[model samples]
Target: MKSYIAAAIQMTSVPDLQKNLVQAEELIELAKGRGAELVCLPENFAFMGEEKDKIAQAEVIAQSSEKFLKTMAQRFQVTILGGGFPVPVSTGKFYNTALLIDPSGQALARYEKVHLFDVNLPDGNTYRESSTVMAGNRIPPVAPTKELGNLGLSVCYDVRFPELYRHLSQMGADVLFVPAAFTAYTGKDHWQVLIQARAIENTCYVIAPAQTGNHYGMRHTHGHATIVDPWGTILADAGDKPGVAIAEINPIRLEQVRRQMPSLQHRVF
Candidate 1:
């Protein structure tokens, strides 16, 4: 794997699908212009609104999101990760899916979010993701690439689960993707810490694209789209804005950190 720049794109997506796509394209262009070869978009890049509204338009959102990723990757000549989007399932619910597309517009990997957020926060915000999103039964996949190294996939809430990233590290992942629309209440406290912990513990670079600001109604996300190195250093942070956080992903640095820490090799259980 060679060194290249990666981007974590932040956006405040609303209920409108086309508007969100336009916004995403602009960010992608910005990242590409900044010399980012691997660009990632935050969760709900296409549509963010009431759960009922999301469910009602799942098919359209799914189709549009997929098409947008492919088009962006091909046009920009960069590998693109659509952090999370709703893909319809046979049971009338959708999977919160993260998809990776190569520069040639082919899908490299896909991950359906396994963990569902079902909680009532202290701020009086309630979320029942399982009501609309069917949890993935299998573990997320790590896609091996000659130039990009092994890339692992996971969604927003999954960042709280360390074992998933452990599995990816065991599978020889060099980088982990945690695309999220993390709630503001939890994000304010847990977002950066969790991401850095994953990177440090697994000794892998982490690219986390995030949604920030108020999407609609009471749904407010903490926006800090970040790229972290293997040693848990914050490379670039797009703080609470609709923008791109660009950083270098270097194999030499990754190997150096792994050899220095040797934590992954020391795992016992």
Candidate 2:
């Protein structure tokens, strides 16, 4: 994998699909302008609304979201990760899916979110993602790109589960993508901490795109789209705003850290 710049895009997506797409395009353009070759959009970059409203428009959302990712990737001539969108499933529910598209608009990898967010926050917000999203049965895939390193895919709440990332690392992942629309209540404390831990433990670069600001009524997200190196250092952070966190993903730095630490090589279990 050659060295390249990656961008984690932060956005305030709402119920309007077109508006969200426009916002995502603008951010992607900004990232590309900043020399980002691998651009990632946050979860729900297409649409974020009530569960009922989302399910009702699931088919439309799925089609439009996939098409948008492909179009953007081809247009920008850069690899893009559309962090989480709804894909209709056989169970009449949808899978929370993350997709990777290459510069030629060809799909490289896809992952359905395995872990669901089902929690009641102290801030008077409750999320039951399983109600609308079908949990994926299979483990996420690591797409080995000739230029981008082995890219591992996961979405949102999966950051809380270290075993999944361990599995990715075991599969030879050099970069992990943890795109999320994390709740404002839980994010202030857990978000960065969890991401850094995953990067440190796995000795992989983490490119995390995030949703920030209020989306709909009573739905606000903590926004700190970030990129961390294998050393668990924050290379770039877009703090609580709609923007891109651009950082260089260097193979030399990755190998240097791995050699210096060698923790992953000493794993006993």
- Maximum-lDDT candidate: 2
How much lDDT does each candidate structure score?
A: 0.95, 0.96
Residue 209 shift from truth in candidate 1, angstroms: 0.3
- Tens-place lDDT digits, model 1, residues 78-147: 9999998999999989999999999999999999999999999999999999999999998999999999
What is candidate 2's local distance difference test score? 0.96
Error of 2 at 186 (Å): 0.5
Writing each residue's lDDT as its tens digit, candidate 2 over 74-106 gives: 999999999999999988899999999999999
The runs of at least 3 residues in candidate 2 whose Cα sits more than 4 Å from the true structure, single-residue gaps closed, are: none
Separate clash counts for every candidate? 0, 0
